[model samples]
Target: MSAEIMPYVVAGAMAGGFINGLAGFGTALFALGFFLVVLPPFQAVAMLVVLSVITGLQGLWIVRAAIRQNTRRLARFLLPGLAGIPIGVMILSVIDASTLKIVVASMLLLYGGYFTLRARLPRFERATPFWDMLVGFLGGILGGAASLSGALPMMWCTLRPWPKQETRAVLQPFNVAVLAVTTILLALKGAYTRETLIYLAIAIPAALLAAQIGITVFKRLSDTAFRRLLILMTFVSGLVLMLRAVL
Candidate 1:
């Protein structure tokens, strides 16, 4: 990457990390929205995969106890997610760059719009195992393709009657596992070039610092406030992604 581009990369990483810390997801949506502006789709996805693992670890640590208590629910989402990653990766390998960008950007726009009007949206009467698996599978595919595995699950979790912490417990660990798999697959596929490593080195510290700030803020927020902030961020992320795709 060029010297001029380093600032954008760092900014994206920090923004993504902060959002992930605050909301327990949206790392890819926010990070990739900025990254695709300065890098190719593959490289941008690769970078976010690595950084997402770091942020995921942070989130998991914050919600470790809750995760242990809800192991069964987590598994319902995770087991299917594991099955879906390779399929998404395979699609990523074959798809053209422009098409990939459009698909990812469109997903962001659609999901973002959904979240923005989520309060007015009807709620699910009950959670089903089938819906959990489907959401996880779709999330895994998106994760493998563009490091966006959390969006679907996050949206699904919101519809349920769970509190904010419980929602984080389910989504954060699932995101960690999916992102870990995606990172490993990318490494095996030789997606991480020397430039990617260089970018990672520069971006990690900024991401960590920003995430800490977000985590601090997150603790003070009520469930209702958190949901509102999440929807607003989702909408903003979608707008940014759409702009990147069009321009």
Candidate 2:
């Protein structure tokens, strides 16, 4: 790898890592968005996955908390979710760039709109097994397409009856396992090449360092403020993605 490109990779990873650590996901989405401006979509996706694995591993420490809270529930929810990963990766292997970008941008817009207008909606807090499966499938599909596996699920899970700590905890292990499985599948599909690996080597540690800062910042914020910020970021990110795709 040329030293010339190393700084850019590190900078991108650092920004991605901070966002992921603050919000539990978005590193890959952000990184891919940035990289796509400079590289081919496949190469961008490959680079995103590499960094996701690093961020996932770095954030895996949150799993201990989940295990302590509700090992049985986590096992049940995450195991089914894990089973969807390979299928998701298979989907990714065949999807073209325009199709993926359109679909992902549309989803972001819809989810962002929903969150933006959430307060005006009727109260509905029922969680059926079907809902879990649906979310798992959507997470897998989106994860494969755009590495957005947990963003939607995170919001939904947090709104569930589960404790805040437990909800957040479950996400890390589930995400790490998903990334691990998908990474192998992506490699098998020829997504990750030597050049991507070199970029990843530079990006991973930078992401981890920024993630530490994000964690500290996240911990300091109030729940209300966090929720508001999450919605705002989602809205802005959705707009950015939509504009990127349309333009």
Q: Candidate 2: where are CA atoms >4 Å away?
A: 86-104, 117-127, 145-147, 161-163
lDDT for position 222 in model 2: 67
What is the lDDT for 47 in model 2? 75
Q: Specify the highest-TM-score model's number.
A: 1
Off by over 4 Å in 1: 1-3, 36-38, 90-125, 145-147, 244-247
TM-score, every prediction: 0.82, 0.78
Cα lDDT over the full model 2: 0.67
Per-residue lDDT tens digits for candidate 2, residues 127-161, read: 46676666766676666665667755665564455
* Candidate 1 lDDT, 104-160, residue by residue in tens: 667666876876776664356576989998999988887667556776786677667
- Worst lDDT window (10 residues) for model 1? 118-127
Rate residue 76 of model 1 by lDDT: 88
